[model samples]
Target: MTFQAETPKDDSARQVGSILAVDCGSVFSRAILVERVEGTYRLVACGEALTQAATGEEVLAGVRRAIQRVAEVTGRALLSERGFPIVPERADGSGVDALVATLSAPPPLRVWLVGLVEEQSLASGMRACQAPYATVCDVLSLVDPAVLDDVGGLTARLQRLRPDVVFLVGGTEEGAEGPIRRGVEALSLAALALSEEARPVLLYGGNSRLRQTVEEIAGPAYRVLAVENVRPSAERERLVPAQNALEGLYLEKASHWDPSLDLLRSWSEHPLQTTARALGHTVRYLGLQAGMDVLAVDLGACTTTVAAQRGQAFTLRSLPGLGMGAWGSGGPKPSPERLALWLPEAIAPEEVLEVAATLGAHPCTMGQVGRELLVEQALARECIARALERAGLRPGLPWDLVVGCGGFLGHLPRPSQAALILLDALQPVGVTVLAVDATFLGPALGAVASVEPLAAAQVLEQDAFLKLGTAVCLEGRGREGDLALRVRVRYENGDTLGVEVRAGTLEVIPLALGERAELELRPGRGFNLGPAHRGRTTRVYADGGVLGVVVDARGRPLSLPAEPGARRQKVQEWHWALGA
Candidate 1:
């Protein structure tokens, strides 16, 4: 099969026919077809299938079947129907205007990690690789004297895996040369062992000492490219170069092994590196075009990725240790001690463990018990906060927007339920606005952005984003009923409105997109919202979006006297006040 790449020009009015996007995630594969109608592309058909039952030839068969099913159900033939043109027949004759497939396969991209110290520089290197779509295949810790002493054994181990690529990361800007030279020495020895054809590509994001050494050593055996060090300083981390390198390696090397690659090769555009790339694209695009920092989290079965964009810099972290899926069988599982730090005392350890294990195993089951649901929310909040911290973004960073993506948050049966899940998961503080990826199309638009940025931006503005207006909450924790949040709106058109809400409440105010409304917040007696955060009146421009207003009641311990029914009553009161 041959791969075709398309460079669609910047013509907003271009009459591109129905185009289908197939995202092969770890748990399931999905197809979405969009048709350009009246100069706007609209989603017309979609389908999904469990991904585990297929691989290799079986994977191709599944795609064929899914595309046909969606076509049949949508009353549009795979090749032809009414105003749409026939998706040009390939030499093999299956139909589609343009088909794009992305994969989030397990045994996720195996990478040979090279770094300075196992604990510090190497640790940061692992974090950098984990940020994109990669798995640490083997870490060659240069600081480990054993690695330097046993070059032959280390070389053998690396050759055995035939890793897709070697990620060479090391050095602090102050003392980079030593570790970088040592890491390159290990890479050179490893390169000598592999056959020319089997020799893995090397991406160096390390110190300057070994630039020429690495290039010369890898020249005859493999492809070597140099980039900026991911951990250039102890205080900051630079991960984009590593992430880009991983995506480059996936397209050039890893795709060849995927069973679905042949089908993807048949499409007219270059294959994408799954939803991760798309999410990265969206974060970057939104950050650049809208002039605001953005954070997007896609919680999937086998892994969860947290991506953030600030200015022109973007960071992505893949938490392989924590996920809503079963593949984390051997890794460190979330413990009671960790859960206890966030959960209320009433939720038993056994119940917390059971819920965590259930989510770890099932990945998709909604919690059946009320208390269990609360525990899950607490876990999600903890996970999100930890991810943000890793990226150097605090929960209260004056972050202009926070968005939730993936099936669990976007496709929930009810909008309120979706909003509540986001509220519980993010536990966002300060005056941040919120939204969810309504179309699950962030990745696709991101890929398109690499080629046609304006088109991608336009599509995102018109179709992908759903605004969930400003969230009003105190910066710190609060007792169960101590702080109340009330919003008063005075429209420019002289309309006056008021709504009283309590902490822990997620209230939805009726507002429409692009429609502007002025908001004023009245914090309870002991609380503040502005300069020292000292101001009494704060005006905000509210845009109708996904999770309207999140009042985090658990700003503090959410304490209630240990009387049996008191805790339940407090929870009920908070829920009632939030209109749950």
Candidate 2:
């Protein structure tokens, strides 16, 4: 499948000023063109097309269509007659100077983990596997009761699982090697049961002294890659080495699954990156740039990822089977009753179940502004909640900024609806800025950062995100109608607006984008804003977003009414309050 944007013309005087990025996802192929406008990088145009893999079409067919759409919208030719991106802009302003791609269309790599300790080395190894588009299908550790009883079951399970990679991690550096040697011996026995082609690649991340032994035990039949010990000591853990190794393996496996990727890979100056990793890189960059803690959530068709950065500490959790799309296919689907918890209207559980099933089979289906949309948003809330729980973020620790990425959050009918969903799902504490990737360019920006850091940074700050305003979340419970917080907003223009918020309600102050306000929050007795300002008056300066300033006094650990009618009514009221 070749993609032709326009007829080639001969002119060689055009200056290089534009960068093109494309992201291939499971459901959609998106393309964006960024050009230097008046000496600053700005988002010039964006295009999207339905990913064609579901229909037995060439994977890049979707990429071709998306890029063509960009050309059509921008009135600039981007591809040549040979169906390849024209590098170096011509005098006719046809080709892009740089082209980059981020992909999440391929399935995650299947990894089987084997380690000595369940909570130490194995835990670190599991986190490492999730760093890329790889899922830990099964874990076999010496501490497991089943393995303890029948040591031989390890080989049986290995053959049964037939994982793409066997990640073996154990022991700290200079620690005992006898147990790790035992693990290698078991893996060698497992290799005997399978043919050379069927054998899984072994990644040995254990005590450094045992590297030679591991390679010798696996011998020539198994492909063994020795990485640094994930648990170098009882008090320290290093996951970068193993995580880097897994990312390479993921790319290799993805290319194998779809040879079409090789063609896409050729267009990039740097190596192709998994969308999740690229997004993480962007998140980390934002955190470092702001010098504050940041958290980002990306809910995709097949996976839900949450990346949190606290100071120098960063944690990323990508749960494969907890996404809103491809639900019930292999990922865990939320129960109808659970989905009902976030519905603003009285939607029958059976109907929710049916819609969810349809979405699972046909992920491309989108809902209009009605019950279907509500159901989808409800599932999205559940997905984010589950992802946050998996990320293990500390409660009451204020996140400086929370960014909502992906289409489900970005393409909402109103920014208010996006705000409500984020507030409900994240339940952030204290003064936190809420933003969304309105352009769906997070992965692209991250991918481009490798080749053009300035482009990524400038585009991100100027046009990529839509600030939704600052959120002030109270952390204490109170009677439904009782006073929660007495808030006073002093705008930069010297105007003041005061409002009283009651428990179990959401309130929005009139603040426009680019506006600034100083909030004086006085919490009611037993109701605190956060750990920082418990039952006291504190002032915070907040920047404006589309929704202006939001005061969520619905209490920490937000709860819904048990009665169906009351829950529906309360949720509806919350939506109305947010102007969603």
Candidate 3:
């Protein structure tokens, strides 16, 4: 297997007919095979198995098992006698042309944040920490209550934490440097207290003027790296610089995360990539290719990532310990009452708590097909909502495409249930196209693009993405049961269906998969589709999937009844409407 750091300018230099990509997640490991069929890249087979890294075994055991399953399905010999992948296919076609991987199973990096102001640079630093798989163990800022102590006190605290990275950020470029310089001194002192081998790496992303002062204070004992200021000015924030630096650190530190990782690295021909960063790459690439604003939400067992791209601007926020796998973990479990708000069935709050506890204890178990499934979906909604809020994305932006990835969203019993979960959580305004990562290969493709851009692009366009259909979500408000939108659906086959959608209700129009239709939407006096289409008639040509065009006239910032009984009824009605 081989990997490249970036796509080469010349695409014709390397030729690969077959590719193998694997993702070693916390709870599950997956493998996929993509091959050229009729001169086009296509997904040939997929296999999944329980991750074996937690059992004191090398991750390769699980990856090999997944590959063995695929080989069984396609009658392809991918692994040799000793479990190592065969490189460069022979005459008999027993090997692949290339191999690549993405990993999310290793322990995240421990980061300590130091900045001048709590609400300014420190807050910006907090968001940047989400770029990599990292946890903020502590923070020291001018406004922090703990900052009242002397340098000695701060040194002792830092000694106890012993974080992997000390991220120092503050002040604007060419702005006040005194406060940030003081911050650097205090943290450098704390870092020097540790032994040479135990000392943490210091990264300064504060005012550029203090770069020399930071190096002088830390001396040679500490490894100091400087990057573009995270806060170039009070009103502007640039996270890519710090995010890139921390991501590099994550790659360096991850090699030691497990005894088997070193072996995995040795077998690889290229550098390992983080799952979150690779997923963000695919999101940005697809958005640019489609020439539209795009948003992607990946719900994993141990993490939930939200990435968005609008024109040339892109943002990614990865929140650890906020996924379905941590639903009832020790950190912060939502109250049953809060979760019950989204449950469609009349389930008691105590029952909800019990199920969440059991699921959290055994996050890898995946046979939920009853009330338990409903509870899990409810938990997914909350997790996605929290990740989006923390992502700091501008609300009410018309997302031309919204893609959902991960097991829970991908393996749902019905497509409408998947669509409904996204709708309830995102509540996106205006018209948007919804799709799912059909083969869980979005990140893998991102890794493969470095070596084979044609294969990655072809598979992504043909077989990797499954469109769940388009959504027409209303943004304005009107009295309940009042007319909100007059919709006319004109199918390509010359069939027409007209419906009057009322406020506070959900409606679905049936259009088969691969079907095409043109919709004419006329909003009522008080309601419109979006900010740009207020009180206007809009026409859109949309494609179909499992669920046709969804007309959500429930208003923006969808409201719910305060009374539990009334809310349950409304929620149940929505489920029935979607046939979920």
Candidate 4:
């Protein structure tokens, strides 16, 4: 079959219509076909297969198979007899205009952090440095127990971590420069002690005024980069400079580290990007386009990534060892008690730990056993929570939506389960919409968004995302079991439903697909739905999904009973109430 697509009228807005994207993930390699049909970009076809790269060089085999499936299904002659993609579509339509790729295959990118204080600049630095591809080996703050302000101690720690990059961030712009200068000296001394072959690269993201002072400390032996201060002030964080530098370095190093990517580079029309980085750019683009704050997370087999954009600010944290696959050298091993906490009944902590340890080495299959599902959700909850806490976003800021990505979330047996995972982990308060990446096409779309902005926006407007309805969650506290919230939803068919949710519980109301609805939320006295609308009725337009309007009265802290039986019963009740 022969196909035709459109090009935007504006030169800058115009993008290649026929594009192919291969996302080489830790567990699976997915290939997708996007073409501008009529006037908008559409996701026409998709295919997936196991990566097997963790075991050997079989990732190439998986990529070929996935692309082949798409080509066969669409009757397209995209690949030659030898299985390589055809470059630039011929007049007969045997190839695509562009081919791009995103990869999450490497172990976490090793990083070391050195800031002025453990809680302020150090914390802000952590927020700036977190990404799915990054692993913060250690944080060396002036107050850290590990740093005694001695050159030997700093050098020893740096040597032990053997980081690929060291970030020196501290001191608000034009604020106390003494502590940051000390950090610069320590990093410089450490760089000198290590052999030239082993010395890590360094970047300074603090105190623009002291740029020359910091440079003098590095001397001629080391290269020091100065970027925007991560914590420009207590009221804000500017991370774009540091984030770009980190990814630029990672991309530079990745070309030499993996030979397989070279094959992809030669076969494709554009450079490859890290999945998380591309996703970050897309998140920023969407937030800006919609003029609202957005939060997204990608829970991978090997890593977990959380990205949020509020206006012009962006925070992305990628935590290693929180996933179902390998996290690289010296990665974290989950505490057994963490996983056991979510089980319905009492189980051996070792059983949970064993499952976690095994999953890190090998991902569990789709048809998981009961215990395995429990472990998976438990780990998922904990991982998402940890990533969020590290972000340290302001409490009063409103989040317009929360999105769940990755295999487990995308392939959830029930839409309600995915909704619950997001609700439980994020606890997004009041007037927030929830959605998934549909079929785990986030990485592919993210890569596509970079070169084809209009195409990306078109695909997003079409069906690139699956709306899972909206959530009105309470944020303030009241006595447990007290009257918490009253929700009323009116559907387009003139049908109406009202529900009362007690404090510290969850309630879900189904809104049929293709149905349009609006909601009125009234919170009880001393209970607030969000920071702005406390004890006031809030109105919002509802988005429908398999599971509709979720009224969560689980309170701000969202506690469970300390007793196992009681907690188990509570868990069952919550799950049953939502039909998850």
Per-residue accuracy of model 4 over 54-124 as CA lDDT, tens digit each: 55664566777778878987898888898799868778877788888887766666789887867778888
Give the deviation of candidate 4 from the true structure as CA RMSD. Answer: 4.9
On residues 9-88, what C-alpha lDDT tens digit does candidate 2 reach at each position? 54363533788989888888889898888867789999988879556786887888899899999899998887888877
Candidate 1 lDDT for residue 449: 46
Error of 2 at 53 (Å): 6.3
Ranking by lDDT: 2, 3, 4, 1
Clashing pairs in 2: 11-91, 13-91, 321-331
Sliding window of 10 residues with minimal summed lDDT for model 4: 1-10
**Which residue ranges in model 3 land beyond 4 Å of their true spot?**
1-14, 142-152, 171-189, 195-197, 209-213, 219-221, 232-236, 394-396
Ranking by TM-score: 2, 3, 4, 1
lDDT of each: 0.62, 0.82, 0.81, 0.75
Candidate of highest lDDT? 2
RMSD of 3: 3.4
| Cα RMSD to the true fold for all candidates | 5.8, 5.2, 3.4, 4.9
TM-score of 3: 0.91
Backbone clash total for model 3 is 0
Whichever of 3 and 4 has more lDDT, that candidate is 3
The true-structure Cα RMSD of candidate 1 reads: 5.8
